[model samples]
Target: MLIFTNMKWQQALKDYKLYLKIERGLSKNSIDNYSRDVDKLIKYLDENKSSNLPINITSEIIQQFIYETSKTINARSQSRLISGLRSFFDYLIFEDYRASNPLELIESPKIGRKLPDTLSEEEIDQLINAVDLSKPQGERNRAILETLYGCGLRVSELINLKLSDLFFDEGFIKVTGKGDKQRFVPIVDITQKYINIYKNEVRNHLKIQPGFEDILFLNRRGKQLTRAMIFTITKQLAEKIGLKKSISPHTFRHSFATHLLENKADLRSIQLMLGHESITTTEIYVHLDKSHLSRALKEFHPRK
Candidate 1:
């Protein structure tokens, strides 16, 4: 017989951190990442309950979370949430906080297959040239577009990016993605050149908002730029170029993934770069890009 002790969700999660470190021999960053995942679970539990507590969590409660998340998040994400719950229960069992892990038999959501869209080298160049370099933000816009294609950042991550995150000296940037997870993504010399040009020639001239002093991108008002602004900018540029494809700041992110996969970049490495918690999410883009096969059809198909 085991006696479950810890009642407070925060306290239990904290103790789980120690177990992941001292017992599991994981690095500090890894332990912290796992903790954040568990925290999200607790938040879900608390918000849905009138009197939330660790003891109140049931299999059905967790299942409800999976269903709700599947509506908004992808299958890859639902899998990560399940993994987080599995870890939480593992910690409970290790600490004797529970007699058994509730997640032992729970199944994960099945993410159906879907391919990602990518731009060809010519298409990418066309998009970059679409920026009106004569304008004040031209250099900045060009660089931002390059960084998006180069770094594969979500709009939120790109907008929330900070000057301090740049590690040009080491050829990488410390990116903070969903759940505040940090990962260092490598930057090539070409991306570095463009970004540095914008930083020196453009971002330096902004009026500079007080609290957002270190933010990388800013509006004319000196405040940080929002994701919507980036979307609007991209949409306008796409129309100006007479392009018919529907795209946004996120298209660049997808393009980044497709380009990398087409070039034969490793799935594990791509997953790391994309800030995904599981490789299953990254694998969706592997054959999904289909650049090689699709181009052949366009080039040789008699219907063309």
Candidate 2:
């Protein structure tokens, strides 16, 4: 085997990060996740007193590391970690730092496809209505929930939304999704109405902070809202409505897709609106509303 000399784990990781960023065009969050996966293996090797170089690390050691870590994480996380390590090793191989990837033959643990939790249309209405209109943040909260459900936006995309992205005249708002890819999602009249009310009434009065002037959603202090804040807002609203199911910002997203599927929206259209990279990801909504599938069969099948 052709072995490259003096390739340390740290240097390999640094180079791999650059590769993911520039060559792969990965977003910062994605790059961090990929790097963190490899970091776990490096931590294990150091603690175990293994002196394996990046080019010289054997599959046995990698397998043992995975085995040890798998004890602490669930199957889904373990699968992701294994996939991440595989990508890292593949990068090393691509750079000719090693002749083969150590994780090449390792199998990921079997995991069932986890169904996403969704709120019913009535539940959604209750949750939104539960917000106290008397409070100064009420309009903003209402608009936030409306936008989340209306656009099926990921929490990251919601928080990062800007004034420049809004195109109400065109009936579409630009969304920057995972990997910084931008797509236009249609906004309904009601959602646009609430957003306009919040923008004109609540957001207009804030002593806007510097550099956050264009950010659509802002904290009371006139800064960008954190992802945690969005989760907290959803959790509070869910509790206020006596909702039993555990929910997050993602629940609204799932509900958005589920409700659409239940109402006979095409999977491909949902995929595009949800900004999913693959139709397979969007197909989960089909599973969420199996009755829709049954109804379709009854309506269109030759034998039915």
Candidate 3:
């Protein structure tokens, strides 16, 4: 067991961050989270009279931390902490700081998945209509909202959309997802028209910055729009419409899938449109249509 204490834990942590960034290609936020978890373990060891060393930390100590963490935090937070710790140890293993990951045997908390909040047809209309068309960027804002609801794009996917991806001739847009994987999602003519209008009228007028030539959505400065900016725009519109239900841009995506499911679009089709890797996720829509579920329930189930 080696002690990182008395030695420079901060320096080692800094180097680990570089490794995560350069070698692992992890995002800055992810690297920060991994560092934060390691910091938590180091702080805990300092208080417990144990050595603040990666090699010295035992699986028993890691399990005890989980138990203590559960006492103070909810399951979700504990789960995040467990994941953070796992990533930290994996980094250590790569750096030869630890022989094995201590977190391998620790079980994650079981969390029941909750369905996403969806907007009713009227609410969806209110949200879209809330945009004041008279203002600058109005058409663009409307198009942004429309694309989100109509296409079911993740916020990141929406922000990172490239001009090369839009294939109006084929009626589909190429989307880059988690793991840098790309998939094609069909784009309706309505969304395509508005996007084209915004692109030609507003986006083309901006001073296009270097390296952002392929980006579809650009800010007034002509650089690509950010995820935060997209959220801010949608949030203001949600408020203007007096929508009591709290929602982000992502709520539009949920509403899109839900509306389709309610309208009798096939689950397999919806799953492919949503880019879900599994049918189980698409089946959540089945629960939304309990009244229309196939037979066997009417005959066998006591509740029916």
Candidate 4:
């Protein structure tokens, strides 16, 4: 067992990052988010000239920091920051660096569930149709948008998608989601056709980078596309079609789930396909389409 009574903020944070990465199997983005929360507290302590270590930091100090933070950020961001700090303190306690979490008594700000925005089927069709086939990158863009909606992929998952992850005969593509969890989402034939065209015609022509040869999506220089690029593509398409509603790659994911629920797909199946760890996370789709619930009631309820 390791012990450190006088561990500095930087050292504790370094160890916490490793714990998050190795022990928790969290993605790099998640580790960075958690570390940012602790970094904020460290900054506060430095500015105030507080010499408290991880083992001796008091709830009052943390509370003061939180109060100062609330002025600048929205309630949702504040709540997430609190939750992230709470996780850090919990880790410190687990490792015996502290007797208890300083954040245990702190209450996160109450925020209502923000429903995700979705695109209608017609809107999705319009966006896809807006892609100019004459452009060199047009086929690739079409494939990317189709894959985003068809597979219900997160931006990270869509970008990290590999050529080897495709199983066309089985009609499913492997997706690596948050925490490196893998799931196979079924792909429709139309989606598959676009991917094949991009892979065979557009992608094959590019001179792929050494490390990124296996990556499914590549930019003009044959490097993996960044998250920002995906956002830009979607935004430009929306603008080109004069779409009024604000949408992103995630909007496609939300539309996928909402459309499925509207067609009477089971919550559990949707949860599995979306790679949601909890059914409650998937339950939000039910609110997106209330008519499905009413239809079920009318068809199955004995009184109805």
Candidate 5:
């Protein structure tokens, strides 16, 4: 095996990041997450005074890193780290930097099927009603929350939504999901009304920046909203409404799919609307729709 330096590893990681961005078309947040796993490994190697280079590092050493990481993070995070490292080493093999991936033999920790938290219809109503509509951004915030629950948008997708994506005439909003993959989600009339109110009454009056002309959601500076801002909005609302269950912008999305499933929406339709690549990902919502499942069992089951 050819010996390499830490600098080589750093360079390889940088190139990998670029490939992820340009070739893979991954979002910045995802790129950051993938890069962070490698960063963690690098940090571990440095702190432990290990001299083994990326090209020559043994699976045993990688295992040690994983072992150390498992001590701090949960199984899910440990699994992500292992997966990330495996992807990085695979990239090295693809680039001819290494003959084989060191992480190929490493196994991920088994994690349980952790379901997401969702809000009841009444809880969602309370949260949305808690928004102070008298403020300048109140309409926009209300619209944002409504769109989140109504459209089942990821926080990133919500922030990146563009005006051109709105197709109210046909009653569907185009959403750019993970990896820049675009999908059209049907919009209800009430959701469209809220969005239109914000766009016409609030968003139109803002001094939009040069490049953000088509961006759907903007802050007071007329620039597009950040993921952090969306989290803050949801967090403040939860606090104001005294919601005990910890929730974020994602909770609204969970509620959206769960509610739909309870209303007899098919798994395939929910998957398409949520931009899930697989039905397996969308099936988790079925677990969240316990009331519907219970009612079905009681109504149809002879034993019940």
Candidate 6:
């Protein structure tokens, strides 16, 4: 390993975070996650009374930290932690601060492939219809649900949606997804109609804050809606309908992809629509409903 002296772990971590943000173009949420991984290692070092800096830290120490972490967290979380540490060490090697990565031989936990939960078409209809249109915010909530299910948007993308991003006439909305990557997703007229009603009837009347004038979804005071507020809205509706499944904003996205796949939408198209970087990510929708696979197999297979 390349030897260095007087380099502090805190300073190295700060520089690594900057590299993640600027050079790697990661989002704040992503940067925070990476930083948290480093923080855990620092905490481990402190607890063990190891004065080792980043340059001097060894694979043995890191492996010990990983071993300790695995005891308290699930396999999936352990896998993520190991992956994060690998990235950090890789960065150090790339910067020539170290000769080799500590995590080169480390492997992630072997967890089963977990499928996302999805709503049936009827269940989705029930949830949307459950919104009380008589209330002023009801139309807005309906629109939010429509966009979530229709466009397969992440919760972060939904809250960050701006008025300028909506090109209804062109039949697509510009979505800024993970890594600040922008893509256009087509919006159906029904989804458009609901959004327009909310914009014209309810959102139009609000005294919008100066900074939030272009935000599509807003609260009573016209401030941008927080992520927790969206979750609360969805949770309250689930309770109102007495739906049995534990769900979140992400459930709608999963339902969107699953439903489309069931209706014979090609995997490539779904990948594009969902803005997935890999087709493997989109392929999980296939596992959501097994009957679809059986039907496809029986219909096309020679034995059938």
On residues 1-304, what C-alpha lDDT tens digit does candidate 3 reach at each position?
Answer: 3254725566767888888877776666678788888787777776777765666678999998778768888988788899988887788888788889999988888987667888898887888888888875788888898899989998888999999999999999999865365789999999999999888888888899999999988887788888999999988987887778889888888888888877667788988888777899888767665664555458568997
How many backbone clashes can be found in candidate 4? 0
Name model 2 segments beyond 4 Å from true: 1-7
Q: Give the TM-score of candidate 6.
A: 0.92
Model 1: ten consecutive residues of lowest lDDT: 1-10
Candidate 1 local distance difference test against the native? 0.79
The clash count of every prediction, one per candidate, is: 0, 0, 0, 0, 0, 0
The parts of candidate 1 lying over 4 Å away from their true place are 1-111, 289-304
The residue-by-residue lDDT of candidate 4 on 54-87, one tens digit each, is: 8888999999999999999999999999999999
On residues 1-304, what C-alpha lDDT tens digit does candidate 1 reach at each position?
0122224777778778878767766656677777877777766665665344565467777777777767888778778778877988877877676776667778877876556556667777888999998887888788888888899998888998899999999999999886576899999899899888888888888789799999987787888988788998888888887877888888888888877878767788899999888898887776665675666668789996
Clashing pairs in 3: none
- Give the lDDT of residue 148 in candidate 4: 95
* lDDT over C-alpha atoms for residue 243 of model 2: 94
lDDT for each residue of candidate 6 in 1-304, tens digit (9 for 90 to 100): 1122224777888899999988988889999999898889888877787778787688899889999988899999999888888899889988999999888888898999998888899989999999999998999999999999999999999999999999999999999998898989999999999999999999999999999999999999989999999999999999999999999999999999998989888899989888888899999888878788888889899999
Instruction: State residue 203's C-alpha deviation in candidate 5, in Å.
Output: 2.7
Off by over 4 Å in 5: 1-4, 47-51, 96-100, 290-304
lDDT of each: 0.79, 0.91, 0.82, 0.93, 0.90, 0.91
Write the number of the candidate with greater lDDT, choosing between 4 and 6: 4
lDDT of 6 at 257: 92
For candidate 4, what is the TM-score?
0.92
Per the 3 Å backbone cut-off, how many clashing residue pairs does candidate 3 have?
A: 0
Model 1 residue 8 CA deviation (Å) reads: 15
